[model samples]
Target: MMIKKLFALFLMLLWPSLSMAQTETITHGSLAIDRAVMRAALPGSKVTAAYMTITNNGAEADRLIGVEFSGAKKSEIHSMEMDGGVMKMRPVTGGLEIKPGESVTLEQGGLHLMFMGLTERPADGETRTLTLIFQKSGSLTITLPVKMMMGGHKTSS
Candidate 1:
C-alpha cells in the first residue's frame, strides 16, 4: 500500500514535464534551431504551419533554402504581410537569410513553413519530423510536436 502511494506521488511530480512540448535543439554547423512547433491542422483542412527560431552562431551567413516534410506533398517557406489594406501570403523566393550572430524567428503573421496537401491530418500530441536545408549547413532534421493554438496560447490537445 505504501509503495502504491509513492508511485502515484512520483507520477504526479513528473506529469508536467512529460506533457510539455519537445525541447530538443538540433544544430548543424553554426546554425541552431530550437522551439520548433507545428500547429495541428483543423478538421477538413489540408494545410498547417510551423514556426521556429534559427540562430547563426558563426561568422559566415547562411540561408534556409528549403524544407522537406514527408507528411505533406509540398512544403514551402512563406511570408505574410499587409499590403494595400489587405493581408497577403506568398512563397518566399530565394530562401531566407540568417546573418552571422543573428537570430531569426518564424512566427505567426510573419515568416513560417507552410505544409500543403498533407497526406494525413496530424493530431494533437503527435510528433512529426521536419528537415531544414541550409545553403552552408546542408540539412538538419528535427522533431516537432503538434499543438493547438487557442486564443494566442498553446494548449496540448
Candidate 2:
C-alpha cells in the first residue's frame, strides 16, 4: 500500500505536465468561466438566470468575488437549498470557494448567477459577455453563447 502511494506521488511530482493537462484547454489559472448562459424571463420581469462552470488550477484555493454583465442592473451568485419539502433559492454570501486543481459547476437547479433588473431581454442566438472577478485572479471576461437550456455540457478534468 505504501509503495502504491509513493508511485502516485512520484507521478504527480515528476510529471507536473500530466497534473496540468485537462480535457479543456485552460488559458489561465486562478480564474475561469465556462458554459455561461442567460435565460430569458417573462416580459417586464426583474430577474434572469445565468449558469456556468468555474475552474481553479492553481495550487491554492481561489475565491469568486463577484460578477458583472451588460443589460442588467445587478448580478449576484445564488444557490438553491432544500428546506423540508420546499426548495428555496438564496444569495450565496461570501462568494464561492474554488479549490486547487478543481472545478465547480453552477447550473440550473443548483447554483447560478442572478441578473436582476435587466434593461432589455436577451434574445436567442446571441452571446452575453460576463466579467468574473476573483479575489486572487482579478477579472476575466468570457463571451457565453446563449443556449436553450443547460444540456450536454461537460466539465474538463
Best by TM-score: 1
Over the stretch 2-43, how does candidate 1's per-residue lDDT look in tens digits?
999999999997764465435466567788787899988878
Write candidate 2's Cα lDDT for 1-109 as tens digits: 9999999998877664454354333344555555566775555666677787888878999888799988889898888878899767788899889999898888877
- Model 2 is weakest, by summed lDDT over 10 consecutive residues, at 148-157
| lDDT of all predictions | 0.84, 0.72
Could you tell me every candidate's TM-score relative to the true structure? 0.80, 0.73
Q: After superposition, how far is residue 75 of candidate 2 from its true place, in Å?
A: 0.7
| Candidate 1 residue pairs in backbone clash | none
In angstroms, the error of model 2 at 86 is 1.6
RMSD of each: 9.5, 10.0
lDDT, model 1: 0.84
User: Which stretch of 10 consecutive residues in model 1 shows the poorest summed lDDT?
Assistant: 148-157
Candidate 2: stretches off by over 4 Å = 1-26, 150-157
- Give Cα distance to truth, residue 123, candidate 2, Å: 1.5
